[model samples]
Target: MPVEIKLFMCRTDNFGALLHDRDSGETAIIDAPEEAPIIDAITHSGWTPSMLLITHHHGDHVEANLALKRRYKLRIIGPEAERDKIPGIDDTVEEGSVIPFGEERIEVISTPGHTAGHVCYHLPKAKAAFTADTLFAMGCGRLFERPAPVMFESLKKLAALPADTAIYCGHEYTLSNARFALTVDPDNAALQARAAKVEALRAEGKPTLPTTIGEELATNPFLRWADPAIRKHLGMEKASDVEVFAEIRRRKDNF
Candidate 1:
C-alpha cells in the first residue's frame, strides 16, 4: 500500500501532520494541539487516526492527546524520556527507533533542547521530517527550557539530513523569522530573495512553510553561523560555531 503524507495547519497556526496508507487505510497524527481541528482534518480527509505521535510534552503540542485518544481511541507515542510528562503514552521511543506509520516507517531522532525531550520524526521514504519547535522555516525555536549549546547540537543533527528533506515544523513563524534572519545575514542574496518571496506569500494570505533543508542550510542564519561571512558580519573574533550561534540566537530573541 502506498502512503500519503498530508500536511495540516491546525489549531491557530500550529501544524498537525497526518500520514495515511491507502491500502491499509491507517492514519497517524503527528502532534495534537486540540481535538476540533484534528477531528476536522480526519473527517475532511476521510481518514481515521490509528496513532498519535507526540514530539514533546509541551501543552501546546500534547494537550489534546488524551482528548483525542478518548475520541478516536488511538495509540499515543512519544519520547521515552518524557513518558512521565505525556498522558496515555502507549509507546515511548528513543533516537534511531523506527515506528510503523501505515506502510511507511518514521525514524525517531532525539533532538532535545526545545524541551529536553523534543524529537523530529523522519520518514526516509517520504523525505519529510516533523520537526516540532526545533527547526522552523527561516528560524530556530527559542532556547527556552534548554541552553543555546544544546539546541545548536540538536540543529546540527537535523542539518545532517538530505538537502531535500521537507521540514514540517510547529509554528507559522516564517515571515517574522525571515525578517530576523535577514538582520543577521543582510548581505546574503539568498536570504534577501527568500524574504521577498515570503513577503509576497504573506501578503497573499498564504503559508510560507515546509521549507526544504537545502534552502535553510543556504539562507537560515541560525543554521549558517559557521559560515565565514556571517561570522564576519557578527564582528566576533575567532568565535566558535556555538559562539556565533549564541550571538545569532540572542540577537534573534531580541529581534
Candidate 2:
C-alpha cells in the first residue's frame, strides 16, 4: 500500500501533516499544530485518524493533541523524555524505535538539540521523512537544550540517509534559511539557484519546503560544514567539522 501525505499550514508557520495509507485507509497526523486545520484537512481527505506522531512537546507542535484525541480515537505517541509534557500521549518512542503505520514502518530517530527529546520520523519505504523542527530545508533548529555538537550529530544522522530522501520539515522557514545559506556559501551555484527559487516561491506566497536530502546536502550551509568554500569563508579552514558547524550556527543565530 502506498502512503499518501498532505501538508498544510497551521499556527502561522507550523506545518500540519496527514499521512494516509491508501489501501488500509489508516491515517496518522505527524503533529497536531492546530485543531481546526487538522480537522479540516482530515474531513477534506475523508480519512479518519488512527495515530498521532509527535516530534517534540513544543506547544506549537502538540497544542491540539488532547483536543484531537478527544474528537477521535487516536494512539498518541511522543518522545519518552517528554512524555509527561505531551497531552494525551498514549505511547513513547526513543532512538532506534520502530512502529508500524498500517503496512509501513516508522523509524524514530532521536534528534535532541531542538529540545532534549526532539525526534524525526523516517519512512524508508516511502522515501519520506518528517524532520519536524530538528532539520529544515536549508538550516537546522537552534541548540535550545543541547550544544552544537549534539545537534550536528543529529543532522549527520539525517544526512546519512539516502540523498534522494524527500524531507518534510515542521515550518516554512526555507526562504530565510536560503538567504542565510547564501551568506556563508556565496560561490555555490547550487545554493544560488536554490535561493532564487525559494525567493520566487515566497514572492508567490508558496511553501518553500519539501526539500530533498540531496538538495540540502548541496546547498544548506549547516549541512555543508565540510565544503571548502564555506570553511574558507568562515576562516575556519583548519577547524574540526564540529567547530566549523558551530561557527556557522553562531553566525546564523546572529544573522
lDDT of each: 0.88, 0.93
Residue-level lDDT of model 1, residues 85-175, one tens digit each, is: 9988999999999997666788999988888888889988878898989999988888877899999999999999999998999988898
Q: Once model 2 is optimally superposed onto the true structure by TM-score, how far is the C-alpha of residue 93 displaced, in angstroms?
A: 0.5
TM-score of each: 0.96, 0.99
| Per-residue lDDT over 1-255 for candidate 2, one digit per residue giving the tens place of the 0 to 100 score | 399999999999999999999978899999999999999999999999999999998899999998999899899999999998999999999999998887899999999998999989999999999999989999999898899999999999999999989999999999899899999999999999989999999999999868899999999888988989899998999999999999999999999
| C-alpha lDDT of candidate 1 relative to the true structure | 0.88
Tell me the RMSD of model 1 versus the true structure: 1.3
Alpha-carbon deviation at 255 in model 1, angstroms: 1.1
Candidate 1, superposed: residue stretches over 4 Å from native: none
